[model samples]
Target: MVEKHTPSFIRKGSGKKKADTTEQFEKAVSRLAEGKYVLRLYVAGMTPNSARAIANLKKICEEHLAGRYDLNVIDVYRKPTLAKGEQIIAAPTLIKKLPLPMRKLIGDMSDEGKVLIGLDIRTR
Candidate 1:
C-alpha cells in the first residue's frame, strides 16, 4: 500500500492561516491602488518648452491624478545643486518619485499617452 503525503499548507486547521494571508495581501493591494503619487518637474528656466511642460504636466495631473498627487516644480537655473543631485542632463524632465520603481520622462510632456504610461495611470 502506498501512503499519500499531503502538503503542509493542506494540513488540517490551515484554512485560518490561509485566509489571514489572503486578507493581508488584499489590504496591501488596496493601499497601493489608493496611494498618493509624488512627482518632480525639473526645468532650465521659464522658457517656452519649460512653460509647455509645466502646463502639460499640470493638466495631466489634474485630469488623472487629481488630489492624489504632489508635484514640485524645480528651476534648474536657480537650483543648480538640486539639478545636479538628481543628475538631470536635460531640461523639461518629469520624475516620478513615489510608488516605487522611479521613472523619468524627458520632453515637453505633450504626449499624453506616453506620460500616462510612464506615470502608471490607468486610462478607461
Candidate 2:
C-alpha cells in the first residue's frame, strides 16, 4: 500500500480560507465605494501648470467624487513649510490623503484616466 498526503492548502477545510478571503475583498470594495476622500494639491504660485492641475482636479472631483471629497489647494510660494512637510519635490503635486493607502500624482493632471486611476476612482 502507498501512503498519500495532501497539501495543507488543498485540505477539505481550506475552502473556509477561500471564503474568508472573498468576504474580506467584498468588505474592502464596499468601504472604498462609500469612503470619503481627502486630497491636497501643492502648487508653485499660480503658474500655468499649477492652474491647469487645479482645474483638472476639480473637474474630476466634481464628476466622480462629487460630495465625497475634501480638496485643499496649497501654494508652495505662500506655504513652503507645508510643502516641505509633505515632501513635495515638484510644482504640481496632488496627494490623496484619505480612503487609506495614500497616493501621489505629479503634473498638470490633464490626463483624466490617469488621474482617475491615481485617485482610485472607479469609472462607471
Candidate 3:
C-alpha cells in the first residue's frame, strides 16, 4: 500500500485559509466584540411597573446577551437629565444603541419572546 503524506501546498503560511474580506471581518468583529450591546433601561421611580420592567429587562439581558451587553438602569425620577438626552417620553423604555439599527421598546418588558424578537436577540 502507498503511504499517505500531507500535501506540499498545505504547509504553514500557505495562504490556503480564506482571507477575511471587509464584510466578513466586520461581521466577525461585531460577533466577537464583547459588550457590544449597549442597553439603557429608563424607568421612573420605584413604582411596581418600573421595578417589573427592570427585572424583566435584566433577566432577558442576562439570558440572551450575557457578557455581551452593558445594561444601564436609569431611574428617570432620580436623574431626569438622562431622560432629556435620550428623549425618553415613557417610563420603562429600553434602547439598544449598538449592533446597528437602534431600537426602542417601551413597556414593562415582561414579554420575553416579544422583547427578544424586538431587540434582534432571538435565535433561530
For model 3, which pairs clash? none
TM-score of each: 0.70, 0.70, 0.67
Q: Per-residue lDDT tens digits of candidate 2, residues 48-74?
A: 897788778877887887777756776
lDDT (Cα atoms) of all candidates against the true structure:
0.71, 0.72, 0.68
**Candidate 3, residue 36: CA error in Å?**
1.9
Off by over 4 Å in 1: 1-34
TM-score of candidate 1 against the unseen true structure: 0.70
